[model samples]
Target chain A: QQQVKQSPQSLIVQKGGISIINCAYENTAFDYFPWYQQFPGKGPALLIAIRPDVSEKKEGRFTISFNKSAKQFSLHIMDSQPGDSATYFCAASRTFGNEKLTFGTGTRLTIIP
Target chain B: DTAVSQTPKYLVTQMGNDKSIKCEQNLGHDTMYWYKQDSKKFLKIMFSYNNKELIINETVPNRFSPKSPDKAHLNLHINSLELGDSAVYFCASSRGLAGVRQETQYFGPGTRLLVL
Candidate 1:
């Protein structure tokens, strides 16, 4: 079973539209949640990360809405642009000592200009 | 640039062949990791090295071995590659220090391996 499950296998949005991707995790041990952006033939880059302590964390136009009670977290891109086109992955890590992260399946987001 | 880098961005070999992928990080991080991303894009951690010590070793096959020559380098060697071994391998690094819990890893471009 996948520890972290991400929704919307793929998403399409017009430029300046709001794009949202949701992820649910089964493990409550997960304390650290992070989102990664990956382009074709490139490594996934760290876009934004958050701890469950905060209900929400926003960086630039990317925001992470964390629901501790529901064990869910979502990434919201405000005013999505064509440059935001990439595969986004949500990951969870338990202890700080263990860097082994449980990554979600992945969500492909395409922004049309 | 100051980042984690891996060699042979692309590797194509036949089954039963032995190959190795080298990784180096100039970020001066104390910990390094090897991750395998399959065709389905499911990324899994295979191994991790802290400083010069072998730390996390996932339930992987014995044929796959990770060698850390020094603190700055970690190489992955595969003996008798199988079709199942075809995937994109990524090398990542992160800081390891006391009182510092969270560290975002920097990943290399990735090495695509195709086993025929």
Candidate 2:
């Protein structure tokens, strides 16, 4: 299946708190996993991504944890702020030649001020 | 300038009408894709084009067709549109068509279709 399942359809966190979103995939052929952040009335933008070769990737305040055997990955946002409030989607793509992505349902994260 | 751009950000039409949404990507990427997000917030791939050629066409209705005039543009044309066709459609692109999943995809702001 092309589906990348995500958990916690919505999330609420306080400012300075940690925000976490989880995703799982069914297609083992998928080689690339990416996370997207989208604000209201905006398109989804790349937040963070990881490959099966590496177990984790950290970019500034955002980090992605990947587990190839589990076929799962997660995005962790540290020091979450109100500006970080938005929808986050986890996606997977075969990418070896076909760079098409299969997106998750999306998680609406609201960081309370 | 926007990396990926689309026309008619919002479209409202009556049932049985025909509509088309045009998308253009300026990122000079080699691959382009179309995704549909429903009211439930579920985003699914509809079609994909590479170098003005069809690469992927999901199990979408025959009423829906995609046309690629060039490497920078992909347009979706729906004939005899139905109420069920209402959703937000997004266009996206990536740099390389064949890689080990290294390049990141750039997404366009999305076209919301409201079929009345």
DockQ, all candidates in order:
0.58, 0.66
Docking outcome class, model 1: medium
lDDT of 2: 0.89
For residues A1-113, could you state the per-residue lDDT of candidate 2 as single tens digits? 87789988999999999999999999988988889998887789998888888998999999999988888999999999999999999999876776568889999999998
Q: Candidate 1 residues B1-116, lDDT tens each? A: 84888999999999999999999999889888899999988888899888878888999999999999988999999999999999999998888543357588889999999999
Superposed Cα deviation of residue A30, candidate 2 (Å) = 1.8
Worst 10 residues of 1 chain A by lDDT: A93-102
TM-score, B chain alone, candidates in order? 0.95, 0.94
* Residue pairs in clash, model 1: none
- Candidate that would win on DockQ: 2
Candidate 2 TM-score for chain A: 0.96
What is each candidate's fraction of native interface contacts (fnat)? Answer: 0.48, 0.67
